[model samples]
Target: MCRWLAYTGNPIHLEAVLFRAKHSLIDQSLHSRLGHTTTNGDGFGIGWYGHPTDIPFRYRCIQPAWSDRNLREAARAIRAPLFVAHVRAATGTPSQETNCHPFRYGRWLFAHNGLVRDYPAVRRDLMLAIAPELFPLIEGSTDSEVMFYLALTFGLERAPVAALERMVGFIEETGRKHGVGEPLNMTVCATDGEQIVAVRYSSEGQSRSLFHSTSFRHLRDLYPDDPRILAAGQNAFLVLSEPLVDLPGWWEAIPESTAVVARGGEIEQYPFTPELA
Candidate 1:
């Protein structure tokens, strides 16, 4: 399993979410309280967009998120209105920079917090399903990256949610054919610089953890003296594999097999299920 977080709203330094929170992503990298693994030190990556540029900037390393000085410096220096950061725990994949999460393609960014059960059984079939144009773009050997490309192959750019549904469906179907009972286990987040879509799903109806922040106004009321909490616009939102803080009413767990969409501070959730491709 892994830990990841996605932030969208008013511009803010990455440190505010990456390092400053009570149990930030960096903290989760060292001591994950909700993940299957306690430590997620295999590798890490961050993807964010800057002003005047729709394409995101991505930085990934084979070093642990908590021990990387470069990541600290970058987090302190860069400010973005939207970003996704991940700390990997290597689910039978190589601990290389390319295997890190927050994989990117064009203006899209994706991160996953779970695994494809018995991936080896379905790897070949899954790879062969990716569009020829997208197959060459896969730079790593992780199921997470393959899932990203699979979603793209199914038209992620045109229909993010539907594409992911079909991708998951394909994965499950492929696994079933190979005799794997439970094929998928994932909490995935993807964005196109305009809207964010996050899903928590699994083939056996048991998924990894995923949470999204409640309205900023509620957070402000909970932390009246915290300037950072008060300064956030009403539209500010965060989605992650775990709650960043222990504050009650500040986070809501995404239901199993559900997709949450956030755009311009407005958030909506829909039931998600695999669709035959």
Candidate 2:
């Protein structure tokens, strides 16, 4: 349905991954190998964190990722310790600025790569579940935006993982109530500048393509001459919809129904299941 990536570690210009990497996010926007579609040209977004602001700065537009000069310039200029980017392939939603990826609130930035199956039948039910105070924050009609707010309503500011589970559980339940089985198919990443949480889950078991880069130390050993590797330090980590390059052993696939957390220069994984109870 879409493709996305998240980065955390030392502060680096977004251009490194979004443009300079082999088969970069910009290239993937036009030639995605693992997404539901080949080109995610409906819209695109970037959300990044810098000093002195708890909230992230966002840039979203309804332009093809490859044609955006502003995005290219911004990528080279903006540097951040943490960032999220998304290339959207509109399932049914309009290709509008508000419908782009990397939605933001407070210090949190989120991006998704899948859909809520048969969303129209379950949209009302899902929106009602969002917290009242946060409901007004919903600016887009995309299911992805709703999912972000649902997480917020379920305490994303505190218990991120648990809140996500609850959000998924509630969506699954609501979908079943409308006879729409298998309502969720998503590989999403959320971050608060402290830690990044990425989940790959689908009610039917098979999820979209999701991968993460190997450790910086390991990568340095593999490509010692690479300046990017040296600049990223030992903590450089990337969670992507697919590998940034064709290099094997550098990117690992996250198994179905799994959750990954990147923090403190480390990666941790755990079983992920919707909490219906």
Q: Which candidate is the best by lDDT?
A: 1
Name the 10 consecutive residues with the lowest summed lDDT in model 1.
Answer: 225-234
What lDDT would each prediction earn against the true structure? 0.91, 0.90
- The list of candidate 1 runs beyond 4 A from truth reads none
Q: What's model 1's lDDT at 236? A: 89
Q: Clashing pairs in model 1? A: none
* Per-prediction TM-score: 0.97, 0.97
Model 2 residue-pair collision total:
0
Error of 2 at 254 (Å): 0.4
